[model samples]
Target: MKTKFLLDPNITFLNHGSFGAVPREVFAVYQQWQRTLENQPVRLLGRKLPSELRAVKSALGSVLNANPENLLLISNVTFGLNLAARSLNLQSGDEILTTTHEYGACLNTLKYLAHKSGARLVQQPVSMPLKSPEDVIEEIWSGVSPKTRLLFLSHITSPTASRFPVAQLCRRANRAGILSIIDGAHAPGQLEIDLAEINADIYMGNCHKWMLSPRGAGFLYAGSAVQAILEPLVVSWGWNVDTPATPEMGLLENLQWTGTYDPSAFLSIPAAIDFQRKHNWINVHMSAQETLSRFLHRFSESFNIPIAYTPEADPYIQMAVLLLPPIKDPEKFQNQLWCKYAIEIPCIEWQEHQFLRVSYQVYNTEADLDRLFSAIEDLMPSFLTTSSHTKSGSL
Candidate 1:
């Protein structure tokens, strides 16, 4: 299974949560699409691209339990999120409610929108050691008011690595007439996503991250009611004033055709989906979970840092966030891990506590976790004791 990925065997790549490792088979398919596009650019882009994109969307929609008509393949989650954010016709005194644990890029998008619109950006602080899904919903909902026009949240948070209860929040927002936008960048492959069941007004996911697609693969899913509000971020072939709209050229036409660009990543989505299916990703996920649980247990005992969630109410599926002792410099420690040990992982300082967000893909094994544990054990003293020792000397 490890041979399937292109990641270097010498480096213990634990940061799958950051930017996913593409399977070699999937990368081959991605390259094939690129070559096919380059062979006859006009024929591929002008003639066959639309139909090919529809097929890709159909395959992706099948995995998400969403309608292809409601989906548009964007460059990435940030691009999709920007489309959703800029589409909202915000006004003064309105608010966009979100959690404090959102991905920084998406949060920045929301902040800019909020600032431009004179809408307040409320960061509802949901404390650590999360209790339950109901509790999460309640805490977020508490920030809502009559002026709350939109609810934005991550399906699986980037920094915290906690799975948010988006379905319940979406349902509540619907009832309250507040539009819901979910950044499901980490959800598509990490969890079973049924968009129909989730029923978010505007949902965007990154196929490149968890779904094992090539980079630049992601999409935005808008419900029928919200589609009218959305205009393409880049207006090119999608919205031509000269050409009249046809029945077939409906929502997809409006959002899909954003000028000529490399559609290889978009076209490779089906191949990636097929790859995951053929490999029986459910079992892979389970094995990863077991490994993560074991690693978390040992890491907690080793560092005296607690795990954020419990089994009965676990938010994460294949990822877990390890609460670390207050390191004087988290960025330095993270860099040292990469530079010294060739251990790639994300360490963040969120809400005054440091956390290591570990992602377990099929390629990772217990031995990988063992190596990480050993490295941390050996380096903890240096990271904690030498706060001002700027030199990258041996511990």
Candidate 2:
């Protein structure tokens, strides 16, 4: 099938785990919303915007299995995490436990919060060559203590692309009386997400990443119990203390409308959902996952790379990270792949070994994987022989 959204045909785009490419149809809908807003800015923003956003949230909620009241549309997962971080009631000696394999931006957010609240951010280490979901949950929970107040985790990690057993961990957190915050940035489109089933106290996901919406589209799902505890990062008209607003009003006023900004991205959520349905995304995802597994198996064997996780244990979608040989200059080697071969994939340095993460979408094919394989085959020998060659080619 031909790709309907992405126009970048020249480059072998395997970086859907990063900022996702939007589908043309959904993007058209986004633009239409933008134009409508521009045509009647006053009516759109002041009168129709709230109702429009509520409908969008309802549509998204039905798919996510979330309460429409609890979910607020945000720009990105980072923004949602930032709101949570700022709202957390951390104190000295309170520990925020997390895995070592989290996204760097989320890690930084946790660090900033820790510094501000005098709370310790404890990073639990999970060794590679993951066997099962239970093993992951065990390794992560072993780090939690009586002082652990919060459990932060990624549903699907950015660097490693391994799917964590967040649902089970969230249950463990509940028993321990620790708050759970899950970064589900890559999980929404890649997996069948039932937020109620997962039951994290706070969960955030990006529609922009894998959901194929426009940039500046994401959601924060806070459980009804924890809604009152969260303070909005931006204090707008929503924080009117004199008005004695309802709980719903508090959420809309404080979090939903965060000053003046384009709501086109949020308004386009239904279109993104509809696009997936029209394309039969479930079948597409399963097919893509199988293709990715085969490619990973072949690529890893050819390059003498190690597999980070077993296929059966963490097979949620089309993202996988292969462990490569330890490179002296990973940054340089990463750049060489892009500069020489027009390959777009993430090369990460994690715990000494370098990792090459390949994210497959509907647009990717075996031909794309072949180009990446060819590029690696050509570059690996040169990188091992001459270190300086890499530096010269890299940006």
Using all chains and alpha carbons, the TM-scores for the candidates as numbered come to 0.95, 0.95
* lDDT digits (tens) for residues 1-395 of candidate 2: 44687557788888888888898888899999989999999999999988898899899999999879889888999999999888888999899999888999999999999999999999999877665888888999999999999999999988778788999999999998999999999998889899999999999999998888999999999988888888778878676668645685645336676789999999998999998888899998889878877887887677555566665586447888766655657788889888988888988887755778888888888898888888877887656644433432221
Q: What is the C-alpha lDDT of each candidate?
A: 0.87, 0.85
Model 2 lDDT, full chain set? 0.85
Q: What is the Cα-based lDDT of residue 125 in candidate 1?
A: 94
Candidate 1 structure, TM-score to reference: 0.95
Q: Each model's number of backbone clashes?
A: 0, 1
- Pull out the clashing pairs in model 1: none
Instruction: Name model 2 segments beyond 4 Å from true.
Output: 248-253, 385-395
User: lDDT score, residue 319, model 2?
Assistant: 89
Q: How displaced is residue 219 in candidate 1, in Å?
A: 1.0
